[model samples]
Target: MKSKKFILESRVKDRVGFQIERILENEKPHLSQGSNFLATIGLVEPFIGLYIKYSC
Candidate 1:
């Protein structure tokens, strides 16, 4: 995950880890999808893009 993907404070980068740790410690929010979409998209999209770029 890129730092400041959610927050863009001037000095937020220094606290990114602490921010996530706080969320995990307090909010405990879950990141998920209905299927394997999130997991496979990272692999599949890049493959498709490479195939298109090199094949055509």
Candidate 2:
């Protein structure tokens, strides 16, 4: 049971990491150092929101 729970959690983590990586790759060209800070927040905000909504 514990192993099953760990597997599910790891899968979710991997999926989220993949999505963030894709977002970063697509946005990299258009972002500069100054705007890069906000871009990080923008990139993660929706995922956090969705995770909260679904995890509940």
Tens-digit lDDT string for candidate 1 (1-56): 46666556646765887788888777533444334677788869998999999997
User: In terms of lDDT, which candidate is strongest?
Assistant: 2
lDDT of 2: 0.94
TM-score of 1: 0.37
TM-score per candidate: 0.37, 0.55
Candidate 2: which stretches are off by over 4 Å? 33-56
Cα lDDT over the full model 1: 0.71
Which pairs of residues have clashing backbones in candidate 2? none
lDDT of each: 0.71, 0.94
| Model 2 agreement with the true structure over 1-56: per-residue lDDT tens digits | 99999999999999999999999999887776568788899999999999999999
Question: Candidate 2, which ten residues in sequence have the lowest lDDT sum?
Answer: 28-37
Best by TM-score: 2
Clash pairs, model 1 backbone: none
Distance (Å) between predicted and true CA of 8, model 2? 0.2
